[model samples]
Structure formats: structure tokens, C-alpha cells
Target: MNSDLLILDYEPAHQPAFRALNHEWIAHYFTIEPIDNEMLDDPEGYILAPGGHIFMASHGGAIVGTCALIKEHKGVYELAKMAVSPRAQGLGIGWALGQAVVAKARQLGAHRVELLSNARLRPALALYAKLGFRHVPVPPTPYQRTNVKMVLDL
Candidate 1:
């Protein structure tokens, strides 16, 4: 993690950055689906209101990264919407955000965390594996781009 990077809880003022960061990465590699719009457009409703959490990464006073822990069931969370600014790539921001979200999940009494992703995202997969996530069977998902599923047991 970069010495100056700070991972903080989501704030309403950070909504634009959160949306932009996620939109950038999703549009770059895959199409943004309707579910993506639902979440990105109203994270407070779909995420935070449901006992989930979102984390934001700040470096040099700019919001460079974002991640979320979406409550799925009691003791389980879905790690989603993680994105790091391309300009801030290689600064360990993604790893830092991942760690922060995992820690947050644990703090929120989560026993497990899962994520939906694509096999094509090797770097992201590597980061998730490094964060203790393991590949699992892909279940039916709303996103057509998701071909990989991972879970981290707490």
C-alpha cells in the first residue's frame, strides 16, 4: 500500500468519484449492465441501506479507488464494485482497498465474502487470490461478463 493512501468509509460527497471510477474500469473491459446502473446510481439504497458498506481510497487528496461489501445474507457479503483509477495503478491501491473491505466485512460480523468477476481479469483475480479469495463454482449471475466466482472465508 502506498504510504499516503487512505481507505475510508463512503460518503455522499464521494458519490461522483465512486461512480466515475467504477464506470471507467467497467466500460474499459466490459459492458455496464443494468444491475451495475442500479448499484452505481444508488449505492445508498442498494448497498448501504442493506447493511453493506463501501470503501473509498484517497491519495494526494484525490479519490483514486473504491470497493464495496454488499450484504447477501446473514454472515455473508459480496465484494463488488472495486475499481482503481488508471493513473493511480501500481500504487497498491487495489490491494489496500481489498484489505480494507475485508476488514470491514469482518468488523460487520460477516463470516464470508464472495465476489463475481471474469477470468479475463487476471490482474484482479491475482489480487483477490492474494487477499485470500479462492475460486469457486460460478453460479447464475446477472452480469454476462462474470465467468469467475471467488470466496474468502473469514
Candidate 2:
């Protein structure tokens, strides 16, 4: 990890940064889905209130990346909404965030962590792979952009 980077749990004040960072990357590659709008509109209600968690990455006091762990069932979580600011792409911010989120999942007692992603996001896929995620059959998904599914057993 970088000396200046911090990965922290989601806070109320981070709402806007959470929404903006994710929306920027999603829109850059594909249009947002209704499910995305639902959570982005009410993260605390949709995620935190439901026993899930979000993680934010900051560098030198500025929020630069975000990721979420959405509880889908007992002992299982969906890793979602990971995004890094365009300017910070090559700095390993995403990798740091991913590693932090997975560690959080283990601490939370989650037995498995899975994710739905688009196959076209090669860099993100590679990052997940390096973090111990492996390919699985693509399940039915709300987002038209999603074509790849991966999971990591905690």
C-alpha cells in the first residue's frame, strides 16, 4: 500500500463521492442499471441497513476510489461498485481497495465473495484475479453490461 493511501469504511459524508466515482466509471464503459440507481440513491438504506458494507479509498485527504460488499445471503457477499478516479487508475488504488474489501469480508464472517462484471473491463478483471477471484458461469444479471462473474472463497 502507498504511504498516503487510506481504506476506510463508508461514512455518511462519503455518499456523494461514492455515487460519483462509481457512476463515472460505469458510464464510461456502459450505461447504469436501475439496480445501480437504487443503491447509489440510498446506500445506507440499501447496503448498510441490510448488513452489508462499503469501503472507500482516499489519497492525501481526497476520496479517490470506492467499493461495496452487498450481502446477498448468509455468509455470502457480492463485491460491487468498485471504481477509481480516472487520474488515479495506474496507481494501484483499485488493487488496494479490492484487497481491503476482501479482508473486510472475512472479518465480517462472509464465507464467499462474488462479483458481477463486464468482460470488457479487462484491467478490473485482472485485478480481481490477482486478488484470488476465479471465473464462474455468468448468472442472470440486471445490468446489460455484465457478462462475467467471479467468486473468491473466504
Candidate 3:
């Protein structure tokens, strides 16, 4: 990661960057589902307003990646929408975003963090494991693309 890389909370101005970054990666691998459209279209409504948090990674003042922790239940959260710009993949931006989310989840008083991912995304799966997430049975989710689920206790 660059020394200049910064991870920060979501702002209204960051809405477009957040949607574009996630859409780029999702479109590259799978079609965006309606649920995806709904959430991406109004993150502050669906995410932040509902007791969740979103974070963005910026480099040289450009948004390069983003991730969010969506509250699933009291003290439980789902880590989702993690994406780095195609040009920034493999540069540890995703990992940095993940770490930031985990820390934020704890700060939010969460007891656990969970995520659903596709088996085809080996790199992401590895990153989750490296971040101390362990394999778990898939939970009900709107995304048909999910084939693997993981969880980490805070």
C-alpha cells in the first residue's frame, strides 16, 4: 500500500465512487442482481441509516476501493461490497479496506463479522482467510453468486 493511501468513512460525495468501484468488479464476474441495484442506488438509506458503516480507500485524493459492514442483527454485521478499481487490484487496497471494516465493526460494538462470496473469487477468499475469517455455511442472501460464506468473531 502507498504511504498516501487513506481509509475513511463514507460521505455523500463518495456515493458515486462507491457505486462505480463495486459495479466494476461485480460486472466483471457476475451480473448485478436487483438487490445489488437497490443497495447501490441508495447506500446511505440501506446501509448507513440502518446502523451500518461504509469505508473508502483513497490514493492521491482518488477513491480507489471501498467496503461496508452491514448490520445483520444486534452485534452482528455482514462485510460486503468490497471492491477495488480494476487498475488497483493486487495492490493490497482490498486488504486495507477489509482491515478497516473489521476495526470499524469492533468500534461499532459488533461481536462478529460475516461475508458471502463466490467460490470463483479465489483471491478474495484467500484475503478473507488471511484476515482471520473462517469458512462457514452459506447464509440466506439475495445474491445468487454467493457460494462461500465466512465469519470472524470480534
TM-score: which candidate is best? 1
* Tens-digit lDDT track of model 2 for 9-76: 89999999999998999889899889888899899999899998999999988999999999999999
TM-score of 1: 0.98
Clash totals, every prediction: 0, 0, 0
Report the CA-based lDDT of candidate 3 relative to the real structure: 0.92
Models sorted by lDDT, best on top: 1, 2, 3
Residue pair clashes in candidate 3 = none
Model 3 lDDT per residue over 4-64, tens place: 7899989999999989998999999999999998998899999999999999999777899
Candidate 1: minimum summed lDDT over ten consecutive residues — where? 1-10
lDDT of 3 at 98: 92
- lDDT value, residue 44 of candidate 3: 96
